[model samples]
Target: MERSLLTRTMARVPGPVTVVTTLDADGKPWGFTASSFSSVSLDPPLVSVCLDKGASTHAAFTTARHFLINVLAEEQHTVARRFATSGIDRFAAGDMETCELGLPGLHHTSVRVACSMHSIVDAGDHSILIGRVEEAFTSDRTPLVYYNRSFARPASNPDRAEQDIRASHIADW
Candidate 1:
């Protein structure tokens, strides 16, 4: 199959937007905008993110056991773009707060989760990094999504903080 066609096909796979953040060997931070993220296990609370082989953040993540997943809000499209691109300091250009793991988490994101690498799977084109959630913070804001090769805001509101079960409607997912 043609690579461009395959990319286009994959692009249509609508997915939630997340910026996987990790600290480099030198203790510098790096982030990548990714839609290839999902919750894989409920027991013990596990999350997964897929990173491309050529991604700058990949090597850092390979050695770093801990990282943060910043689930973007619809308003954070610019943040996503900055992190997705190269040759610029993504963190220096944004307003952010550091997590306990020292990963940069977008302050305005709909949710932020600090996690330790549960496992790493060697997928053909990308590496799938599974994470065990250590701490999570959720906000009552609509999420940012990616679809058809572009960014999007959620159609509805996502309650701030899943601190209470009553706030997360099962129907939202």
Candidate 2:
């Protein structure tokens, strides 16, 4: 199978946009936008995020003791784009704060998970970093989503009830 074909197929699968942040050894914050985050375990409360091997922030994150995953809200598309771009000062984009774990976190996100680095696994062209959730926070905002190479949000209609929307189109997958 061609890599491009596989990528295109995966693009159809929607995923929550996230900004994973960590501080380097010198206390300089580093972060990157990702849509490849997922919950791995519930017993120990673990989650995983994958970063491209060539990403500028990869080394810093792989070596960091802790990190925070800020699940972007629909209104935070700019935040997602900023972190995804290369060669930009992501932290300077603003709306960031220090979490209890001392990792940088985005403000007003749908959710924030502060985690301790548990394991790093080398995959084909990326590295998967698994973290043990130490603390988490959630807000009532709608989560930012990525699909077909663009940002998206869950449909909302004033006349349609939440349960109606879910029953009509939302799938467990």
Candidate 3:
């Protein structure tokens, strides 16, 4: 299958925007925006997020003992873009606060999952970090969605809903 074709097909399937955060050995926070996050199990409470092997924070996350997954709210699209950009101070915005499990997390998110590293699986050009859920936080806010390479929100009233795809400047990771 063609890579562009596969990318376009997957883009049509909306995904929740999340920023996965972890601290380096020096205790400095590092993170990357990801839409490839999912629940893997419930018995031992496992969740997984895919990190591009080329991501700037890839090394930090792959070696970290714990991490946090912040499911961004609809209004937090900017935060997602900031984290996704390479060669910039993703944490300079100071929007993150120390939260559950003492990991940096974005407040007012739709959900936050704190996890301890369980296992790492090599998958093609990415590494799948499967984590054991240590704690979770949730709010009633609507989660931000990434669809068709744009930021979106679920329509509250489909009948009268208009397409609201905000063009995003985030580069593909």
Candidate 4:
């Protein structure tokens, strides 16, 4: 199968946007935007995020003892884009804060998962980093989603549409 076919198929599936952060050996913070994040094991509270082998932050994360997954809100598209960009300093803007675990985290996000590095697996062109959740925080804001190569939000009125259908059925009866 062609790579583009796989890419296109995956693009159709929406995913939550996140900023994965970790500290370097010298204590400098590093991060990258990712949509390839998901829960792994509930019993161990493990989560995984995939990083390209060539990503600038790959070395820092692979060696770090802990990392934070900052799940972006719908209002944080700019922050997501900034982290995804290459060659720019991601933490230079001071938009991040130090979590209780001493890792970097983004403010005003939907959720933050501070995790200790559990394991690493090499897959195709990327490396999967599994982390055991040590601490987690969540907000009321809705998550930012990525679909078809663009950001989106969950539909807000599905319940209303269902009510409308119900009302119509009642009228017909």
- Model 2 regions more than 4 Å off: 156-173
Q: Between prediction 1 and prediction 4, which has the larger TM-score?
A: 4
Query: Which clashing pairs does model 2 show?
Result: none
Task: Estimate, for each residue in 58-89, the C-alpha lDDT of model 3 and write its tens digit.
Answer: 89999999999999999999999999899999
TM-score for all models, in order of appearance: 0.84, 0.90, 0.89, 0.90
Residue-pair clashes per prediction, in order, are 4, 0, 0, 0
C-alpha-based local distance difference test score of model 4 = 0.94
lDDT of 4 by residue, 119-139 (tens): 999998899999999999999
How would you order the candidates by TM-score, starting with the best?
4, 2, 3, 1
Clashing pairs in 1: 138-161, 139-160, 140-159, 140-160
Residue 142 in candidate 3, Cα distance off native in Å: 0.5
| lDDT (Cα, tens digit) per residue for candidate 1, span 30-79 | 78999988998989899999999888778888888799999899988888
Candidate 1, residue 135: Cα displacement in angstroms equals: 0.6
lDDT of 4 at 79: 93
For each candidate, what is the lDDT? 0.85, 0.93, 0.93, 0.94
Q: How big is the positional error of residue 140 in model 4, measured in Å on the Cα after superposition? A: 0.3
